[model samples]
Target: MVFLVCLIFCFLAPALEAQVAVRDTVLTVRPGDSLLAIAHRLLRYSTEYTAGELVDRIKRENGLQGDAIQMGQLLDVSLSYAELLDQPVIRGTNFAARGIYITAALAGSRRMLTLADALVAAGGNTVVFDVKDRYGNLGYASSVPLALEIGAGQRAPIAQPAKMLDALHRRNIHVVARLTCFYDARLARQRPDFVPFSREGPGLWSERGKSNWVDPSLPQVQEYLLAIVREVAELGVDEIQLDYVRFPTEGNLADAVFAFDPAVVPKDRIITDFVTEVERVLEPMGVLLSADIFGVAAWGREADRRTIGQHLPDLLPHLDAVSPMLYPSHFEDGFERIDRPVDYPYYFLLQGCQRLQKLATEHDVLVRPWIQSFDYRVTDFDSLYVTEQLHGAEDGGARGWLLWNPASLYEIGFAAIKGFTDSTAATVPVKLRFPKSLGMDLTRPTSVAD
Candidate 1:
């Protein structure tokens, strides 16, 4: 009899453990259902409860920690909701196979919709929005006094940052905040000492003729950017993508000079210091940090490092991900050998990403290359080229990619990718594939990048 009981107990344990106490329910609150009303309705059959008692019970039931409900949030009021009230809710980070950028202004203004609407238009799932722009302007009003002082505070055309985040979180869309670092014209003019200046002259700026850029060497510069990163962190952004992380590259090198005091620091040290400081601030917060490096840097040559101050091995340690700007037009002659660099987008993009993949593998860092979505000097930017580049990035072993169109307009390129069918709904998954002919590794690295 004792042996029979033990066998029964063993058989029942697995089934009990497998059973989830709460069913996966998506409750849509009707227009008339108040917090109290819903509770009374769900508990009407219970003999001991009054309607008034049911209302309070319902508030407790739905794990409505606060007495509030939005118009149409599909609440997951399962048995777990009550137990998980104080804990940080974990949401999915599944991004769409193809994603696009939406300016904060556009996202807020006429294009504004329930977080659902915006996701559907871009083929759904992932959103890359501007938290801070090239001009150092914040998309939403900020609590930081320095942000407001520099005119960084502006209402995101979308109006509600928290509400938007909650909506997107519910839909499982990965939200990435694009923060433009070092390219602040407004702050540069306001704080001239923080800007990079030419060593040739007391007042000369770099050749890009852009008079703005925070001196990367300044400790205060890193502090200022960290302040912004922290503010966005509180909003629950999945990732913080640092743009313009490099020194000014297009300017006349002969005339243009770095203002960072050489007696105090070395050039390579300055770049790494800024990245390390940013990582130091962000690491404790548990946020993913990524930096954009010029495509040429992946080649691991001295000239590339001199031009952009970006050394792959040096930067790999400080970043969770590195995005190389592999836009074909940005390459020089003999890249893919199609005569005009613009004419041969696929060749340069594929080769550039392949080289970057190899370099990143050596360093053991994640590579997510930025692909060209717009036509530069050439006029033929169709679906075929866009798909080809996407395939190339995947083939080169990149985890994912970002499409670049300075104007924020994306249509033909988005349509070209396969697997996704819904273009009018809020969130949907799209499938993508890398051709078998091209070899790349998708596995996580066993060792960290140097």
Candidate 2:
């Protein structure tokens, strides 16, 4: 019997390695210990499930139909790996995830450690790395069958992702792995059937001089994206952020043919369902999920939401946080009746964050806007300009903010944050606080106007 048990344990070890165990403990019902209290204590920092949900689970586990428990009665309780990992960093009591964006190449290079230090010195504690990009290349080696079969891991940059994650965790830095969905050039090229067909031409439809995007409504595409998320979450990322999760807005959109008819299924539903499915799969793994949207989503325009397949009302409820790329340069002149909107960095971010935060609050989600760090329109773009945007976001009640520079050159941003931290710390303690609890509610307004 001992020999048989040993063989069985060895056989199941590899399979069990991929699964997160439900940590179970037996506890005696003590004086003043209510079921709700116990659930909250077990899942205080957990973003995956609520106290009520856990209460129900506990009742089910012990086969008790009633919430009442007798003193001295023993019960078995469980906590998830996700709950265990959801913790506040040592940087501050209130953990606001002030973060910077890093590309896969930078994340894989030796300079990544130096960049992490620079971020910390700037009073930032989060790093968002693009694990899968528009080109459909995985930054690290992947074992996902579809990714391997399609050569998505051909240019694996971060050879040992686990080691890198361990290094970042040691530094108290939150890691958000960004995966570019839908707009995948590599997947579209190798799997032409997944991409949109051209009504006006013979070839697959693509953004003009740009990449081809997969159809979000397709089950295969959704499963493939979820597979990537599962693989990344398994590698121990703190969060998984989806970029370009929406439908394509550029190119000859009128001439493109998707797998499903937009008139029947509607683009918004397709996008929302995909996000919901991702959340369902990721929540159990103990990792938070987020998505990046066009800055215009904050404006609450129905036409734009329909065009891009990202309705804040539909999307926000499913995400732990929503990152709107609120870059001033991306806005055109005369937006919000302000001429040369790019010139007024503070005004743009303040307005955008105020609108987004209000809507996100209704859905029990966090608003973490992406601020522009690169110079584009403003001639005197410098540290002061970055500082102004940061001020606006904070003033507008954003939980945290991320700096965006495509090339990863953020010296201006670094200086801006450091200056703010130094100046603010002299007067009062400055701490960025991450949300204590996050919940998903499907009962949001159908539209922003509603």
Best by lDDT: 2
The parts of candidate 1 lying over 4 Å away from their true place are 1-98, 110-124, 154-158, 204-208, 257-264, 333-338, 362-364, 419-450
Q: List the residue pairs that clash in candidate 2.
A: 82-286, 95-434, 96-432, 96-434
Give the number of the best model, judged by TM-score: 2
TM-score between model 2 and native: 0.74
Superposed Cα deviation of residue 211, candidate 1 (Å)? 0.6
lDDT by residue for model 1 (105-202), tens: 75544343443454455455556788888877787778876777766675444444654555455555666788888787767876777776676768
List model 2 lDDT by residue over 266-333, tens digit each: 89899999999999998777788889999888888888977889878878899888888989898987
Residue 121, candidate 2: alpha-carbon lDDT: 92
Model 2 Cα shift for residue 237 (angstroms): 0.3
Q: Where is model 2 more than 4 Å wrong at Cα?
A: 1-95, 209-211, 424-450
